[model samples]
Target: MAALLAARAFLEIRYLAGDARRVSEDRSPEDDLERIRFLADVCHNMPGIAQPRPWRPSRRGAPGSSVQQAMAKRPMGWAWHTAGPEKRAWMLRHIENAGLQWTPPPPLPARRKGPSPMTLRQRAGVLLGRWPVRPPAGHLSLPPEAHVLKALDSDAICALYEEAGRLRLGLGKGGPWLRAHLDADSVHYLVPDPASYYWPGMPSTRGEIDWWQCTALLRMCDGEQVSGMVAVLPETFAALPSTLPRRKQVRLVHHARTTERDTYLWGRDHKAECDPQLCGFVPETTGDPPPDD
Candidate 1:
């Protein structure tokens, strides 16, 4: 029984060795040529690296086989022999431009000192006698009666306002404009002229607001002239040590104080939003208006 077990173990070891040898032999000459070409290209691109010599097949080993014939015709040198199977496989994938030849990257241009050149649009505006209007600096001050429901971190606020009807405060020199639900479906906006409440430093095209940089300013009175609304931070409802309790009673106002003029002029030029729901489709209309406004 001991002899029989030893024989079985020997046979298993021989079988594994045979399998490994077969796998090695199965690699085609084309594969070796590809590897050799890739390595040659890499060596050529990198300075001071020695190029691999071509592979020459042994006449004693499978002399008439296609692989041997191919190797005889074009020998791929000894460079690939040192690379393990895993390394060879990785090299195959990362060979630049199919191992044709290595092209060195162009050198970067010299940097110019001082202010950058004006854009074509800016130049054109000047040529047309239109002076560029600069936006005001600082945060847009809220109305005297505006109430802060809660204070929270930026991430929490962005998540909370991720939904369709969230409001955004655009700070400008003229004053802050309360844009109604960010992605609501109202045909008409509360503020008709968008330029009047220009957001400072915002790109000409629509840009996103960082929730951390903004404070939620809600109007709490409903005296016909006053708009009653509430802005709450998401962190206020989260499970954190510094989180504040979520506010109640105050309604989420979806009324926009300004409409995008370009939307009307250009027939609704679609702007991509981080949240897909905020883009293209109008948000479902819900939430009651605050009483007394």
Candidate 2:
């Protein structure tokens, strides 16, 4: 802006009327005028624009500048962008010497956005079925029966994952529910991962269906609407406190927390530092990484 102002001022002083007929314009005299304007516009205790009072654009139509004369110049732009290179360099140095230190701010970042919690719950609504018995491949189905709970929440549904139980989805219509799953049958397929020091997920040995999918499926049956979120390990590593509370049975309920963001397994990266009994997993051998080109 200072540069723009200085350039505009130069345009007015040189091309427009100032000295009646002819003034070759000696540097020393003209620069003194610029220094005075620079002081008034850019220095401390500036009139009506200092602290507690901001420089308002509506009043001036442009950002405050070192060269006040530029703000008054008839047309904005007015060849300011196309000004001679030598004059531009001179104006830049003039503004720089006048204590102009800031660069124009960069553009703002894009907003963070995604599916809302209700939308997520709706998504979870679609993943449900009888866990032990899947319906025919072509049709979408719910549970064998639906229970109308006075109230249901994440905690209520998460409890089923901790040990065992059954869940069903229903049609508001008439009789039988759409789908169902035997919650205990899920645990038999799970192996406690010592390295994680807690239950990791609803991973299965029998099929590709895993914790991420299971979490969504279970949320659909909960008495309350549940967010369709799943546990995720960050690309970076951090320590996760034991989800398994001391002296209590290991449970998968912690993953159901809405505030839960990243889950970590410290032993995955620092196996030697973690306790063997609590965090040990047999190490798998891997070939050395190939060299970078």
Candidate 3:
């Protein structure tokens, strides 16, 4: 029974050291030494095991006799080997907390190739608004061109023309109202018709020339609001020379027929309003434009 218990303990030690080979029945002192050396090697090589620092003597000096003092200076594994079961168990717990374990962690699963075809389809559907198209609550109609001009004074009209010409020269968007300071006293303004979609340098949309002619007359009264109207046709608006003067500025405004202020107010009040569906029709320039007052 004594031999059996010793063999069991030896096997347990061997297992901790990760040695699978069977132990010899007639093991010698040399064999025991070799087993201890193997366990020391295993503990040192374990990933999370901390390196043991040299034990220091107390301020009072060595704790015991010269023989005991020498033992204290020996390697940590030497103490571990001589420790009782309770001390050994405590050391094993510390080892576990340090992440030193017998078994390795499992490998991670492989990643997928790419987004599936169905996912791509769903994304396309969302972008095109084909999946769920909601109609707008109220349609914003443009007032007649006469009404829009009546709201502005002659100075405002000139400022609009100068600024619109400047924007046309630079091919950029003017904030709020299109404005240009032509010297201190000279400024021009023009009501940009938000219904026109200007795609400069591209082929003019079907009936664009006729639509502009009618709209220009309606907005500026054939150059009555400021100076002569300059129609920036697709090619002209896009590739016109930067040196072109205010005389060459177009009287057209491009976008949905709604002012920035009106759009902001509408969005603020009707938070859930759906975006209006864009119909390819050019708006009529004959009727009274939407009321600005």
Instruction: State the local distance difference test value for candidate 2.
Output: 0.27
Cα lDDT computed for each candidate against the true fold: 0.29, 0.27, 0.31
RMSD of each: 27.1, 23.4, 33.2
Quote the positional error of residue 246 for candidate 1 in Å.
Answer: 45
For residue 190, give model 2's deviation from the true position in Å: 10
Better of 1 and 2 by TM-score: 2
Cα error, candidate 3, residue 71 (Å)? 99
Instruction: Report the alpha-carbon TM-score of model 1 versus the true structure.
Output: 0.16
Off by over 4 Å in 1: 1-98, 119-121, 127-293
lDDT tens readout by residue for model 3, 1-293: 11222344455566544433334345555666676664454343232223444544321111232333443443343344555575456456555655665332122222221111233543454344331111122322222221122123434434433444464432222222222111223323333232223312223544322212111212221121221232322332223223322222221221111112221222233323322232111223222112221
lDDT of 1 by residue, 200-260 (tens): 2335334632212222322211111121222222333323233222222011111111111
- Rank all candidate structures by their lDDT, best first, as comma-separated numbers: 3, 1, 2
TM-score for each predicted model, relative to the true structure: 0.16, 0.17, 0.15
Best by lDDT: 3
Alpha-carbon error at 60 in model 1, in Å? 70
lDDT by residue (43-150, candidate 2, tens digit) is: 222222212233332211112222223423422222334345654465566667666763422322221122123234323432442022122233233222211111
- Worst 10-residue lDDT window for candidate 2 reads 169-178
Backbone clash tally (model 1)? 9
Query: Residue 290 deviation, candidate 1, in Å?
Result: 45
Per-residue lDDT value at 77 in model 3: 32
